[model samples]
Target: MSHGWSIARRLFLAHALFILVLAAFVGTASFVDARDRGYSETADRMLAVATAIADNPLVLEASRGADPSGSLQPYALRVAADADLDFITIMDTDRTRWTHPTTSEIGKEYIGAVGPALAGEPLTEVSTGTLGPSVRAVVPVTDEQGAVRALVAVGVTTSNVTIALNARLPAVLGLALALLAAGSIATWLLGRYLRRVTLGWGPEQLAQLFVYLDSVLHSVREGLVLVDPRGELVLYNDQAARLLGIPPRSPAGAAAGGAPLLADLDLPASLGELLQSGRPARDEIHPTGSRVLVVSQQPALASAAGRGKPAAMGSVATIRDHTDLQSLGNELQGMRTLSDALRAQTHEHSNRLHVLVSLMELGRIPEALEFATRDLELSQQLTDELVTSVDEPVIGALLMGKAAQAHELGIALTVEASGSLSDSGLLVQDLVTVLGNLMDNALDAAVSGEAPRTVDLRVSSTADALVIEVADSGPGVAAEAEEDVFRPGFSTKDPGAYGRGLGLALVRQTVARLGGSLVIGRHQGAVFTVTIPTHRSPEPTPAADQAQAPRA
Candidate 1:
């Protein structure tokens, strides 16, 4: 047979260990009990006969003197004859046999389980021999004065004990076999009962389990996915579907095999490597669309029984929507910037007010009036910018924030965006993604250049497309970085970096999805132009469910 993997081997070993432990316990207990019972029964009978002889007052008194020639010989003969026994012996306290039916045995020392009996208490035990285990007993003898004097002892060889034990041998063996059989049967019955309790429920439990699972799946705000060991998806949630732009329901189940519903979602290459290696991979899938998805993965631990064996294996993936989170973060930054601006303005205003009071006191009203007029002009400019925004709230707020940032950075921003886009067919959010990345890149390029840097921006729309163009006066694109500029994974920074930086690539993807085109070249500086068809709206996307085949 071929060697198996950890998971399969583990299952087999688990079952084997359980049986081994149970059998060992039962066998040990049985051996101990049978050994104890057999020894005790033999010993009990011998000790009783020995004690009866010790209890004889005549024998106790005679054993104390221990002169077998006069009293012991007669007593030993009388007892043996009366009990209808073969052998009998009486001893002094030192365990020397004083009376033996065989004259040679008299006055001989017999060592055995006789110490306690010689010390004035009756006792019994057994010792093993070449033939088998034997039983022996000792009983104390007392003098006429009631003082303990000697002991009475009796025993039989294993051969004799066996003749007596053979009568019960059938019953003993039968009981032992019954016990073993009962133990094995009991273990199996218990195992069956446990299985019934845990796995025998009908469809009611199955439905409830499914409902419970569904509730758990939906409760998780993050998209959760469970794949079989074969790397096929078995479970996926609503959030995962929505973030991937998958249909509400496909005729097939979630994560169906056919042309993956959101196949266009750029899965990281590292994830593929992880799957092959039985590891896990994760990264943020940033699509320049409505949302950013946080993809996470965890590899399933192989079942120990399948050690080094072919077995089912898979991983779990979670996708969380970070779009709202990004919006909240942006709002918080805006608030912080607003706070800083208010603090600075308030401090400056306080100083100016103090100066104005001093000037009025000094009758210098003209200088104070000039200061007030300048402040008024600045306020009016801010108000005009707010009213003449490029588009919706999210866009207008972002642009205003960027403008404030530029002013803080001492960088001049020449905003020349045209056309009323609030009513345009293009998603304002998608436009923001395209514009935001380009604007940020331009700003970064401008920062390292000479002082008083400027970024030229123009946004316009034609009858069939929405166009966005950005030109910066910084040093033109580096020759080396240009070729890989729009490549999917070719980033300007380190390869292992957390920032995927598919800004240009994301721009390309979003444009293509919207049935549009993009061009990049120099326009006296760095230039980027993107065009997307300006349809009224996209057609309602259909569900993408399809039947799936069983995993290999």
Candidate 2:
């Protein structure tokens, strides 16, 4: 908003002023040189005319005769007219004029210097005489014995010299004008180029914009990255460096020359590929190392007010950490799974009570009692088995809740857990995250599959490692999509389905964080296996198997 004089306009004005001053200086110097040369030429010509007249034999004879002006006056007039001289004077050494351009002054004392001529030296100077200021020359005539006899003075007036200098003025002025025009044109072209590059912004405006942008990049909560059209990493802020697990750049590294290339960055495959493709993405989720990030990208462009349409400058991407958010979402999902299971159980218990009350009223107490006993035994068996198996109560509760949920949905879920996982050298939250997501995926798969829907879960902790496997009776992942299943935002379900692809991505991230490996294989259904190395050794225990019967 701080509008100021544009660089183009400023440069144009400055250069134009410079050209004007230069032209004035050059023109003045040229005019002065021409005037001086004109005066010098005039003086030289006057000196030649004066010396020629003094050397004339007719002049000597006329001057020596009784009547000097009788012949000299006509002769002086003829020579002055022929030589373009302003005036001619014939005088004696006593400063008495014999002949003159003005005939009235004839035989009068000369109005100008005659001593130099009497001394027998030819003298040339600019002097004010009866005819006005002129470049004049005076020379003396000598006899055969070298005694001075007479004098001749010849000059061209200052007016005539000025006229001659003016005659050459057009050429000098024309050359100066041509140089000034050339300079102006060149300045205009340079100004135009500067305008295009700077987008007509002044230096101060550009500097202010840069300062604001730099502050935003550093102060904003989200990570920001800028890539050039050639896939080079042109800029990245501190948050971006931290999220991407790269070294932070120095302050001076904000410059393009100091920034690293995209290929040189140790980025996750999905993110690296996305940046390299220069594709626009909105709120995309990606997993890198132990962290999950939500990223958005768009193509950057330069203004189109120049020579052509807007051009692709590069791409700008923003990143926000999603790891904590994903963890919280997983916890909420676990709670929802437990809530659904409780609701189903409550519904079943209420139905059973209604049946019992109806039977009692109909006097069929034995059948009601038998049904109740069988239901209690089945529920009690599952609870006892899980309690004996999973040492971590949180994990046990999660598995139990999932089993109950599956039973209500008419899917048989079997869980086999062995060896104490309490000493598995993994955080309880991490363990729950890994197992909960896998079970959720399994249950969802089984519930949507063909008749006799079933899911199998196996968890075992050894002296060196902990392993978990979940197999579901559903359509397995496609061979082509096997690698993509773990990528964020990839799903076998409808693309528009809410929260479709994030579950498996979180599972993969957790497993990797625990330094585990997950393998996908097919038997009657899809089987997912995870193995995480551990340094702790736990006491061996008999395997416990708990199975939930499908609802009848």
Candidate 3:
């Protein structure tokens, strides 16, 4: 088994190692340069001293004498001692030494390169001679006519160069050590900063977190979009792209100057406005293409520990596909209405039965028979009227069921029909959604009002469109709020009601989906008018009838 270091430790270690290597390289170069400079300075001083000796008139005159060494020996020795030179040799142009540091080496041929000197050139170099390795310079001694008279050589031994280099080593090493320490400190500080930025998570932990967050964002059904405070898109999940009907990835040039703009996504105008507003919004239903999305938005906020105000960072929005849910809810509501109608019918039948029994007990057999016969005839008449007037079974059953409910609620419900409907393109579900919500709203409004409450429903069909108008005897919608009534979650009824406002919105959506138009009439009470286009077909089948039948 092997254990790995944390990210902070690994980063610190790598930085420290790099600094160490760099410091070593710099230190090595500095040391080599210092040694070379020391040697060069020593060689230049030797060359200058040798040139001065060669330029002396007395030395030049003596070098041309019968015994040059006899005159040059003392002068060379004194100069060598005073100038701290390891060796100084004066020689004739034949490369024969006239003076040397050791007397035994005098009069011997020079054991180093003297070719440049013989050609009357002055030069400096490090070379091995009778005195081990030394930095030496050779200068050609010239007479008054500039003719070469002799060669003068001076040098500092390798041992002296070593001493000089050693003198500067401590300071160079100290500087290198200081740099290493500073680098270590910097590396440690950088590591600490990175740790804080990462919230103390290592690379493995961060990777895991990223994978988990990505999975959750993609797996969830709701669409999620995050935008910066400047109305630029920051992050969005796959669901968002799917919901908006956009490509899975941002398009080329979608981001302006490396920051994505929300407007580039081509969202619905209402949704774009909401996202740009950066305000908290809840349950704002907006239509996009053929889908209806319920969007909720919240601002991302952050605050310092001692700060009095929170800073607005950005906004996050969740989009839910509510089209299917709303349709199913509309169907469920229709079933509930049918159930209420059946209950009312049952109550009415029980009341009639009690009346018949009471009449029989009173010993008025003829009156009892007449009463029973009259009640049965009236019920049959209403059924006949509904069956004869409305040809569409779904609409007919819905109206009959709503009439029964209204009767129980003490609201007079009236249904008037003028034409028949074909089942070709007329969806029963859509009709139920439209008519059920309208009648339910009308009944609720009329029954809650003063006496003589009434709801009038008029149905008429043309060769191209079906018209429905529902009017209720209640306080009409306020002028200012009429336009807002169709907006989701907008209701003038009880504020605590959760689902009261969605009915009218759903009705409007269904009408629009069928390429129909809904208008609110400026009448004594609230009047809603809807017109839906239709297509003709053959008579309804048994299956169609059964599908359209009310649950009761």
Q: What is the C-alpha RMSD of each candidate to the true structure, in Å?
A: 21.0, 8.2, 6.3
**Winner by TM-score:** 3
- Candidate 1 vs candidate 2: which has greater lDDT? 2
Rank candidates, TM-score, best first: 3, 2, 1
How do the residues 1-552 of candidate 2 rate in per-residue lDDT, one tens digit apiece?
Answer: 235988888998899889988988998898999888888888888889899899999988887889888889889999999998889998877878888888788878887777778988999888998889889999999999999999999998898888888899998899789879988999999898888878998989888888888888889999998888888777888999899888877446666376677788888888998887778999888888888898999998786365667788889999999888877887888889899989999998999899989989999999989989999998899898877778988899888888888988899888888887888778888888889888888887887788789999899998888999999998877788888888788876775564678778888888887788999999777899999997784444544222343445
Instruction: Identify the leading candidate in terms of lDDT.
Output: 2
Ranking 2 against 3 by TM-score, winner: 3
Model 3 C-alpha lDDT per residue in residues 1-552, reported as the tens digit of each score: 112455777788889999999889878888999998999899889889988988898788898699988988998889888988899999978878999989998888988888888888899999999989999999998877888989999998999999999999988898788889999999999988776556556688777877786777778889988788888876677788888876664423333346558778777677899988888988887766557788999998765433458778799999999888777776677788789988988988899899889989999889989988998899999888877788888778877888778888888878888877644378777778888888888888887777789999888887788999999998877878876887766776774465667778778878877889998875658999999998867678999999999998
State the lDDT of candidate 1 residue by residue for 481-500, as single tens digits. Answer: 77567653465456455434
Give lDDT for model 2: 0.86
Candidate 3 least-lDDT 10 residues: 248-257
Q: Total clashing residue pairs per candidate?
A: 25, 0, 0
The models' CA-based lDDT, in order, is 0.63, 0.86, 0.83
